[model samples]
Each structure stands twice: as structure tokens, then as C-alpha cells.
Target: MAKPNLPVFNSPEEQFQQLRKLIIERIIVLMDSNFSSLINLLYRADVDEFKLKKALAENPDNPAEIIADAYIQRQLQKIETRKKYRK
Candidate 1:
């Protein structure tokens, strides 16, 4: 039997992020096994949230959309923070 080896990263923070992403994927898979709608809605909400942020950055004059986007982004942040911390 041979021992397996993993690559080392110069930056621990970057390594942490890569590991975090893998964990999040495992979580989404688990969620899909049960609450599929929740998973889908979360995915769509994230995409919309990102688009809104980009729009706000690209067009600061759009007050209405900016406000809506800020609200959605905040809500998503809260949800994600809660979910991540709970795990």
C-alpha cells in the first residue's frame, strides 16, 4: 500500500477558500436530495443577486434597481452566513 499525497498551497487563505467551496458543493448536493426547490431558488437568487451588483456598479444612476439589488444581496448574504455558520 502507498500513501497518497496532496498538493501544498503557498497561501493558507486560498486553500481555505478551495476547501470551503468543496464543502458548499457537498451541502448543495445534500440539500438537493431533499429540498430541491430550495436549492434551485437559491441558485437563481445568487445569479440575480450577482447581476444586480454588477448593474449597480456599471450604472449608479439607476436608483430603483440599485435599491432592489441591495436588498436582495443583503438578504442573500444573511441567508448564506447563517447557513455556513450553522454547519
Candidate 2:
């Protein structure tokens, strides 16, 4: 019998990086075509408004990267909290 193809698994760090790149791309598209949607997403994702604004101001040329990093950090925080509570 032929062996079946299996999905490749990435390390956690690699997976996170891939997700971060995807998020940055999406944020860039939203910035160009629908900025309000990006703002709404940031708010919904629980990214700190003050920090995001500050980061954007500091990195005026790379707002997408800043926003994506903030979003990912928030998600990681939530995961940690959940793990802590579950234990």
C-alpha cells in the first residue's frame, strides 16, 4: 500500500512568524483600502489604543508591522492567561 501524504508541521516560533507575516499583509491591505476596518479590528483584538498610537507615530513608515506586532502580543497574552487559569 502507498503511504499517505501527511501535513508538514512547523515549530511554534515558525508558525507564529508565518501568522505575523500574514497579519502584516492583511493590515497593509486594510490600511490602503479600508483604514476604519483596521482600526475596528485593532479595537476588537484588544490592542492598547495608546500604545498603538504611540508606535504608529514612532514608526510612521511601518504602521502595518507595528499593528501586527501589537495584535500578536495581545493574542499571546490571552493564551498565557488561559493556560494559567486552566492549571
Candidate 3:
């Protein structure tokens, strides 16, 4: 009998980059079509409003990239908090 091939997994860094790219793409779409919804999402996600505003002001040419980065950082912070408190 032939052995079945196992699915290959991406490295953590690669996985993270893929996710980041997807998020940036989505953010760009939302920015163009439904900005209020994007704001609601960021609010619900608990990304720092002040930092996000500052980033947007500083990098007005790439708001999607800034928003994606803030969202990713906020998620990472939440994960770390959960792990730290799970004990």
C-alpha cells in the first residue's frame, strides 16, 4: 500500500506574514467601501485609538498598512495576556 502524504505546515513567520498580508488587503477594501465598519471593527478589537490615529496621521499614504499593523499588534498583545493569565 502507498503511504499518504501529510499536509505541509507553514513556519510561524510565514504564517504570520500571510495573515498580515490578508489583513492589509481586507483593510484596503474596507477603507475604500465601508470605512465606518472598519472603525467599528478596530474599536471592537480594542486597538489603541490614539496610536491608530497617530499612525494614520503620520502615514496618510498607507492607512491600510498602519491599521493592519495595529490590529496584529493588538491581537498579539491579547494572546500574550491570555497565556500569562491562564496559569
Full-model lDDT for every candidate:
0.56, 0.84, 0.87
TM-score of each: 0.32, 0.81, 0.85
Winner by TM-score between candidate 3 and candidate 1: 3
Leading candidate by lDDT: 3
Runs in model 1 deviating more than 4 A are 1-60
lDDT of 1 by residue, 1-87 (tens): 233343677898777556545544544554447566544554655546566568768887753445344445656688989999999
Order by TM-score, highest first: 3, 2, 1
lDDT of 2 by residue, 1-87 (tens): 233343355687776677677788888889899999988988898999998899889889988899999999999899999999998
| Per-residue C-alpha lDDT of model 3 across residues 50-84, encoded as one tens digit per residue | 99999989889988899999999999999999999
Q: State residue 3's C-alpha deviation in candidate 1, in Å.
A: 62
| RMSD score of candidate 3 (Å) | 7.2
Clashing pairs in 3: none
How far off is residue 34 in model 1, in Å?
Answer: 42
Instruction: Check candidate 2 and list the clashing pairs.
Output: none
